[model samples]
Target: MDYLPLAQALADQLHADGIPEHIASLFRRVPRHAFLPDVMWGDGRTRYDRAEDPDGWMRAAYSDQPLTTQVDDGAEGGPGIATSSSSAPSVMARMLTAARIEPGHRVMEIGTGTGYHAALLCELVGDIRVTTIEIDQEVADRAHSALIAEDYAPELVTADAEKLASIGDGRHHRIIATCQVAEIPEAWLVQLHARGRLITPWAPTPGAPAGVLAVLEDCGGDVQGRFEGSLAFMWARGQRRGGHMVPDVDAVPDRITHADGDPRTLLDGETGLLMSLLVPGWAHGMAMEPGASEPHVWAVSTRCGSWARMHPDGRVEQFGPRRLAEEFAGALTWWRGEGRPTVDDFGLTVTADGCRSVWLREPRAELWTLHAADHDDADDVG
Candidate 1:
């Protein structure tokens, strides 16, 4: 396939999306094909036009981009599930931009998915000082092989990234994670030098549209930083332990709410807008599944059960049994009570012992402080 044109097109798209010049140049410089394997390619008969090869899927390995190397590799269903892959180009660009890497900066990366990101780091900073860890042995080996093939190798380790302190001197200037993390892994905080910056996709807050880009500051104790932007990524492997079972909303009868008149109006009108405003971080809207030929209905999972709800307006009654809709609604109510401030109004303070998220109204004024443990399983902001 014609690779250069594909790379140019990808770059153009990134530029159009408001990516900075230097970051876009990095994409232009890295060859994506070097990172992908031949088996990952689609049938040669497929058209290579822009529509088909948008973002250079045909030349995924050659362009300075990320590709999905494996899907559902560890799950019971085999490879049908996208368990892992190289991150997307624009996503990588945004992440790298968030990292704000500088020359001679000591960098540690978690989740060496395809070694694609590692290669980019190697390009930006010499390989000698860059370290990356992957939890999957097979994936790590493949990434190592790819890096060796490209003759640009960095320190690749096949171990749990949660134990980051074992490598190096435990003093990295920058720490980045491509995978989604439920909590700020303690090892990262231990490894980062004072004033070091750590960037990662934090676990999604219930009813939020996307994960927050956690920018951590290593203070020689705990790490602290405010959210930079919205990011979504696959949860870290170890973090995905439990099966997503629906919650029993019926247990809390008092939380349920009902309205009169057109059901769709309640589901789609002010309630919807208010819900979005309240749970700005949630990925989907509240859905009411009317029972077949019956007034009884259930509120199903929205955005893949990222949020749940129970609303009934005569014609339809919906409730979530396995979801956190009630909790989401409560959070929304809390936000409303606080005047519905934008996300910018929120601030975070993390120490080695624990972390606290606060909503700030003005300089030196206290609003609310939510405590988040370093290893809490709850998907709230931490």
Candidate 2:
């Protein structure tokens, strides 16, 4: 079972993805399988065991896809929700490139999921300059063992990433987070060296599995940056969105109205991105019942427990204090009026007071403010 060729093939894929040859070469240097556990979950939650199928596992280890390494936070006989994973090599490469790692720069990784990324950091900046943190004790311990076994030791800490200042003594040249956070912790900004860069996935609300990558650079007193691409990572532990009850359509509706536009289009691409920013603390998705003709689009407001459901015929049913569906429709209208800006045109500015403002095109064109973590309400217009 020669794995070098597979490693080379993965490197080739990374190179094709615009990764520099030197960084792509690191893929060839660091064997991904060395950091993986015996069991891994693939697409559709299909479990693969190295012991049972060595060749298949090897192939999957080199595949350009995320492998779920921890389910339900490593609990037994629980729902198979992916709690952690080895991010696709391409994603790691892109984020590493965004961080722009240098030879002597101190790097801090927020989520050391599989230790593979830590190994790459070690290769770039040496073991002494890298510090990786993971919230789950079990996950951290496993990553630590894997890293040590491979003789690539970095400072591995088992604690919540929210407590960044307490874990390390000094500021770092670069900081990267493996998990998505709704709010960028102020400590991350404060713990950065002058002109330091922090790369992480940022979602509009808690518990979102997918979000745009934030490539922020620290200014003298604030950290500001723009969204680049989308990344799907598990939410930060303390900020994970909890379970919410769905609104019953059978009950007497609080309001019945017609949607401003096609409800399905509200949560797609640029429109979806705008809606997330405009209507914070709301989760939306589309679902189709078995044998149904068309899917139903739904939105639920986490701030007020308001819910809205729209059928295929443009009819909307709302049952709560806030009109989430109406708000989403209004957001879509506003987006169109603004010439439909792409996610790339968006930027974020976090001031010294821990306030986050999402701007359009430029920092001065601030659209709205993202509420602090302690605030129970959703964001409001600036």
Candidate 3:
């Protein structure tokens, strides 16, 4: 039932991911299993209890993969969606390295899912210098208990991350998030210390399960940065992904047209990610009938209740106040004209006054301004 070797093996695996020496040492010092819940499982709630299956439990507990620890916001689970988890150790190491945390740096983390990363931060810095905020009370309480069990106590607060400014007093040297946010909040920027860094997953729209990780530094009066990696994390509860609005173009006699372009072809790879960027408040989903040859790519905009369906044969159906099909086609065209920049080519600029804009190539060439939260019926340029 010994777990040190297993924990060390996990640390070794993370080290292979190119984590720097100082950061790697911190991860190696903390026992990962100590932060896990009584039961461990995959995305699905398949419990692996340590007492019942010691070998299997230790294996899962130290495998360097995310362990789903809470479901339905910790509402006594019975086949509900997993809401939070301990991020995979490898990804955590990468994020920590990207953060470039220095000794005696004040660190604050959003979404302390299991307090594992917070504990790692405490190991790197000191417990008094670390502050973590979690939205779910039950999840935060569980993480608190786990932290205490390991004799590693950091300040744990249960509150919405959106209210971070009111809760997270004082400047932070480094800020990171365990959850994904649709847009980088102005609150995070205001609280970040001068030259401080904030690393979090930035999803283009609400409810997106996967997004590119952003490593931003406070640049004088603004916070700007670029995308580095991709990971899947739960969306911020208040900012939960829901930008999609189905267009009733067919239900009502609106407009049906044959499009010169196929979305499936245009939005094939990185272009799909670009489409979300070019057009704000819009989401793209693809589906096919049972046993169909190809799927129809649908673009739903919360902006004007507009919708476009690009069929496999390339016919496009559109409806609502705006012509989303044309919007998508145009966006794809502009993106290609820019030499088809990948996600890494993208950057963000958030001014001190809370004005946020995403740019391509450089900040001066501003692309779009992201509102703090998803509001109803915004204009549709997409």
Candidate 4:
């Protein structure tokens, strides 16, 4: 249970991972083992373990990483799933980098899973300037007690972070959410100070693998931004339900045309990356589940009655009882024509009431908007 050596090794790993010097120093100083629970799982063993054990808890605590503590809590069968967790160190670092936190800056963080990130923030900036919110009361209380034990306390609010504007006085310099949002919540944009940055994982369309990191800018009243990187996170509270049912491909219409294309090419291609770069709004890439035995496939809800299947030999088959295959084909065609830009090509612009993402290309400059005041309306632009 040697803590110092564990911390030193974690610091070394983070440095090698490109974490900044000042931030790495903060990791070095923080007592990560103190933030974890006394009885925890490690190396396949579930028991009362010492937090400072180098090959045990300390490795997980100090490494720029995430660890799962709970799955489905309060579900029909005890904890239903690993619905929430402490984020990975590298992922948190990427988020902090995207957040661009500065000394003395007022920061608000959503989804205080294990309070590890909050502790990191408290170490980076004094606790007074940091505010963290969590929805689960039990989790929040646990995090609160853990932070208190380490003497690194920040304002921990047991509430939904999407409603941050209700608890905070005014705007904050930076706002970050570890949870994935289907769309940018308006409360976030409204509570952000001018020029402030909001970073969150934008959930993928219905059946996509992971979400995208959206970096938004707050102008007077509007907030605008684009996807920066690919990330996989648990869906935010509101988006975590009702969509787990498997889609029925056979129930769809059969108006789609079988075309010749590489299935692996479509799955592993740069189409999604390019679309996000060229088109400012949310974009996705999907393939049909290969066969009953092959589990890869592409289908868009917009073409609910249709689906496209990629074969092992670089061939594509579009079949369904309905005929939205044209739309699917067109969308794919459009994505291919757009030069396949990556997430870095998008930029954000914010205004007093809303935000917009504009593609910097010529002729047909594409744009998408989200409005802050109309967030509750679901369809409001930011």
Candidate 5:
């Protein structure tokens, strides 16, 4: 009841976050609660029910924070992993702004989620020009019903969006993926118009400080763009991996060596981002064990199960095949050689043959090839 004022307030906050008034106004028109399920999860995975607490639900709906709409991929409660969510209004605005949506533009959204962003796309572009895709059929059906109930009918497709060859090439004027990918899929590049922009959240490895928002433009057949800012989203279904923690390995050390410095420093600032790209397929974490003198820094590779641990006293212990500690140190040396560039200093290029190349400053400055199979399972950090 009377949720318009709350929507307006949320829109105001979006405007304050640099979202254009015209785009933010869409929130005022479309109520966020209309797309949400009756039972939702908020911060700390706490449950919020519309029937039990109507006012709290309404306030949460209009708030700028994200609400989990589906958990455990629609399975009954097991461990409550958020599979899909209504992204924060501010992030939605930022991605929309990055998209540069215009009236009559053919827009394609990769993940429909709760259909809230799809509704916003309909507002920017006409309803007929919006085509939303959701991999989960149940989620897509629910979104379709919500959109229909709101008198907004757009093309809703329930299928995997990893490779959109079936959607045809040179179709969409703008393509946006609500999920994160390890690398840009070549199909997404092919499906865009000559001047189209593809925006998605990308994280090469778990060592990344944060997931980056990549706003790419197709140059002829090749796609390239700079990492604009930080934006963390859920992993795409095809690219999803298992949990990331210090791997369970042999108790006895295979090899030990002296570290150059505190290995934890590798997790600092842009170093982590650089390490993520260079040391692909590896996840890192730091913790002090019970009855331990100092905390240890651990790095484990998801691809090969290689593990490395650096003690607080600069002693590095490594096992398995890859020598992850050496690779990480080499990456750190390279970062220092390049003047310690930040995330903004990096950009990605995906060629016609699907080769991903991450560059520093400019594409020609310094580049590293990222193999398609080198994705990690670590979540993005702020």
Candidate 6:
């Protein structure tokens, strides 16, 4: 029944990962089970219930992996699709450490989720200094209930994280987002105080499946920081494909344009990271068919109804209004020109004049300013 030993075990992993001792100390104190729901999306995409499997539930609660708490914005239940989850403990350690939370610091957490991290934040910086925002009411209600039950009452606001800084009157010394963001919203910049740090997972594009961690430090209204590491949190619900993404990979192509290029190189690892950053609105994936010589590499546009695929022979096929394969070629050429920069060779800078830019080598001499994601899934939405 005791989870401290389990919590300590998780903390030990964080220590090994080089998470600071103070952060590990807080990880040791918080009981993760209290913040989790009775039912969680478990391994193999199945539900783990406390009543049916109490022992299994405790094991999962204290385990190192993420446990999904909501699916399809909580509209559809069971293990269909995960829209939210308690982040893995190791990631929590890194983000919390990167946040640099200190005494008297006001911290704003963008996505409250189960409030597990918010509770940890409260324990670190005091309840009065923490403000957490959640979009889903049922999820927020549950988190609120849990926090209250534990006697940690930091401000809980149920609203879209993108819209909060608009009405926020107070400045935050530290701002951490659990959700994945495509472009850093202007509001997040407004709420961040000078010398504050805004830590978030900036996905090239995927409703927060996984992406590099950006640790931007505030100087006046502008922020200067680089990608610190990788994180795999759920994307904010509003930013989800129409609020969360569900790609139509197997859908019959509307049209196929024969192109010549090898897109297989851009679908899986570090190079995939580059593809995402270079070409903003498309989601890339791989499907291995049984008895096939090579896996099918696929890319679908999150906007404009475009798709691209590369067969084993290096022949490329593109569908819809845009030639996604050609876009891939351009991106590849750009990356090659840049010396095939790794994810580490990148960083982001937001100027006080309110211009947001992505950079290479350093924050100055801005590389490009990302535009607002075109959520025009009008053709794909059914």
lDDT of 6: 0.76
* lDDT, model 4: 0.63
lDDT of 6 by residue, 1-382 (tens): 6777888888888888898998988878888899998999766776789999898888899887889987777775555678889988878888998888888899999999999999999999899889998888998999999999888999999987786655356688899999887667777888887788999988755632258899999876778788875555667665655432333445566555544555576566666676665555677666665677787787777766677777676756666887777876787888898788777777877676544566776866455564434333322110
Candidate 1 overall Cα lDDT vs. reference?
0.61
TM-score of each: 0.73, 0.92, 0.86, 0.79, 0.88, 0.83
Segments of candidate 2 deviating more than 4 angstroms: 207-209, 243-245, 259-262, 285-295, 378-382
* Model 5 lDDT, residue 303, Cα: 61
Judged by TM-score relative to the true structure, which candidate is superior, 1 or 5? 5
Q: Give each prediction's root-mean-square deviation over alpha carbons.
A: 6.3, 2.4, 3.3, 4.8, 4.1, 5.1
Ranking by lDDT: 2, 5, 6, 3, 4, 1
lDDT for each candidate structure: 0.61, 0.82, 0.75, 0.63, 0.81, 0.76
Better of 2 and 3 by lDDT: 2
- The residue-by-residue lDDT of candidate 2 on 221-284, one tens digit each, is 6899988867668888877766655555454568888765666667767566667866667777
Model 3 Cα lDDT, one tens digit per residue, 1-382 = 6877877777776677677777777666888878887787763456888888888887888777778887776666466777888888888888898898888999999998888899999998889999999988888888899899988889998888776665446689898988887666667776689999999888667633247788888999588888785666778887775546544433452677775546565555565666666666666666675676877777776666676777776677777777876776788778778797787888776677655677777877777775545343333322
Decreasing TM-score order of the candidates: 2, 5, 3, 6, 4, 1
lDDT of 1 at 346: 45
Top lDDT model: 2
For model 3, state the Cα shift of residue 356 in Å: 2.0
Candidate 5 displacement at residue 179 in angstroms: 0.6
